[model samples]
Target: MQPTKTNIFLYLVAILVNLLSFSIGVSITWITSVIPKVDGSTITDDNPFGRLLTASEISWIAGFLPLGAAIGPLAVGKISDKIGRKKSLLILGCVNILSLVITVFAKQTVLFYISRFLAGVVLGSSYSVIPVFMAEISENHNRGALGCSVGIFVAIGMNFALVAGPYLSISVYSLLCISPLLIFVPGFFILSPETPWYLAARNDEKRLTKSLLKLRNKTVEEIHLEMTSILEVVVENETAAKAGVRDLCTNNTLRKSLLICLVIICLQQCGGIAAVLIYMPKIFEAAKTNLAPEICAIIVGVFQVFGTIVSSVVVDRLGRRILLLVSSVFTCLTLVTLGLYFRLNLSDVVWLSWLPLFSLVVYIFTFNVGLGPVPWVVMSELFPSNFTSIAAALTSSTCFMNTFIVTVTFPYLSTFLGMANCFFLFTVVTICGAIFIYMVLPETKGKSLQEIQKLLGSCG
Candidate 1:
């Protein structure tokens, strides 16, 4: 709590690690702004591509990112465990840089698809590695806030893409987004320390001691106590043999943790966040609001960033379960309202046209407050250090898979069922998700990693 050297160091590292989220945000949301321009617009003589993309090509460009992301985490997760979190993150940065380069030079639809797919790989890698890195480096009290920083930066990235994409050409936007990756790659290398938890798990006592010293402002006794706690969990994990997919499935605690993680991520995706983000411009276009669709998207992105900042501030104080429960309930309500607004718009309800915009803003805000970040934070807290990589990979993969499904099918589903009916279905899912969380999730405020592990283990 005091402004010691260690505290300053940890906060600096937290800031650096969270920058990865910005690249992720840009990658995922870039298409949202880019698609409208490239889909139907006339190509100027000066334009390098010289052709507009077809609808089917746009769909592939949109859908393949998550598909590639689904594959990225599986490999990156294992690589993170084998190498280290820092190195894995650097690799992600490299991937992002390469993807941007491809995007800049890409003249063909296939090249665009490949660039987007590569971007997805960075996203998948970041989601898998960054949580583990934050959890291992942060003190118990700071863990939740640091974990939620990922969401904060992600929101910032989304907003940046939304606000800038309309103004800048695709090439300019791609180049601008690469700045963060460039800064993050070297900045992290110089500033960040390997996590003490990771060092202990790898049986490197000297580095573990050094890492603990850099991360903690406590006395030698307190540092020893913390080291012992981490070691006990590491030893217990080792006793079960090497941690893997089988260990995650066969061990009772790890299994429960994996299930909870997967369920949370599924609910997070199915709750319609991806659908809302992907279709924001279309939604605004359909609503025929006074503001331009791009402007409305910027507003929504601003709200999202604000909500994530609020979540970072209160996640430790309010606790995870309460925020998630509250978030789910309110999000369901907003979705229902949005559904009704869309349904009414189909009628002669001209005066209530503003409801869609209002409801979506509220919905995005509520989601970022809890459901957006808490699930990832809880996922990091749930698994032991030994199993964190594989579990994170599996969970991150599941999240992206669901995202892919929702992203790919949303246009068709909304077309067939109508936007109102689509949202109505999501409302039902939100309700179910709320009930599950209230009945099952444990409060993880102020608890150490080992304590949380024991608490979860005892649940079985």
Candidate 2:
């Protein structure tokens, strides 16, 4: 069925808000552009420090972002619940801009570490709330597609950094990254509407009406019909005491939902994506590819973007379960081949030099199509509204923590174990991931929040 004008407006708003992800994408991969320049091997015009950083320091620079992100969701959860998702996002946008400004002006290694950590704070918080905000405002039929938009912008942002970080000065590149939020923060405040779910939860019927009016291009009767559905949810929620952290364990539906999200997110991170994305140029260099590492990185970034865009188009139509299963299985295959390519590259195999590039491209594309996006989509869908913020905080924290471990340890692991061994380890993890998905996960396509909760409750 063709979407209504309301659906189009919903999509436009979702795309705009996800500009936050674009900024994050730049921050995440900014290391790719600047790592070489700052290693003290050559004093470039843009190098801010006179001293060289240790290998450990460089890893911390990469690690600090996710480490800070691990803490951000904790605060953002309460803030989002108390103040509302829209305002919480605005606060994060402002904080994100501040972190970027610090990055642009940073002169000392300590200062750079602080700025990166703060940027990670924004990353964790944004991931915690953004998908829930998107889901809360959208209908069940289109929620998967909209949630997957998050990955598209993230990939685009990563591509932006990969493309621009190589040419721009460190300060100039950071300022360019900040430019999105300069528009996004103000535009979001003035143009974006508060989610009806938040308004309903607050029991502010008047504001709820205004929010719906702004979001939906529907007649009053149609708006009222939707409002009725939202109110039913709210009233149902009111019947129970407000959900607390305790509910996450005691409530069977919530416990299951949280477990599913955590496992999927863990699988997503352990697949070695964090290491590949943050250290893309370095990974290509390690593999001894014929293409310029920069060119190869950008090619992978472009493929990442294209894959996510395809995912956004097909997620609602295809159902989440199959996409995830296919994504995990193929991801396992690609990682195995990538590991083998790296292993064989050791022997001066000239004919198979092309294998690394082909394997990486397929790996990146397949990863984005499903595993990259589906976990977040499932995370957003499975929670009850009352416990969403709490569940998101927990899930977001776990996601970044796993990411931090993988990203921080990658250099040492690659050096000691060899890059091929690292991919082999990720391949093993991916196989386990596929098994988990097949054994436990339910298809959430076209299901309402209530329906999803019931489905989860019934699952073994």
What is the lDDT of every predicted structure here? 0.87, 0.88
Off by over 4 Å in 1: 44-48, 217-222, 346-348
- Model 2 earns a TM-score of 0.97
lDDT of 2 at 3: 77
lDDT, candidate 2, 1-460, per-residue tens: 8877787788778877898988887778888888877775767787878766788988999899999999999989999999999999999899899988987888888888999999999999999999989998888777898899998998899899999988988899899999999988988888889899999999899999988877788767779988998889878976874778887888777778888899999999999999988788787777777889889988988999998998999999998988899899888998898888777774267777777777788888989999998888999989778888988999999999999999999999999999889999999999988899899899999999988877998884
lDDT per residue for candidate 1 within 1-460, as digits (tens), equals 5588877888888888878888898888988888777765677532446788776677788888888888899999889878898899988888889999988878888888898899888887789899899899988888999999999999999999999988887888889989988888999998777888788888998888878877786767779988887888888878866888987888888888998889888899998998889779998888778788899999999999999999999999999999899899889999998888778774246677677778888999999999999999999999878889988999999999999999998988988999889999999988988888988888899998888988998888
Candidate 2 Cα outliers beyond 4 Å, as residue runs: 1-4
Q: What is the lDDT of residue 359 in candidate 2?
A: 79
Q: What is the lDDT of residue 148 in candidate 2?
A: 93
For all predicted structures, in order, the TM-scores are: 0.96, 0.97
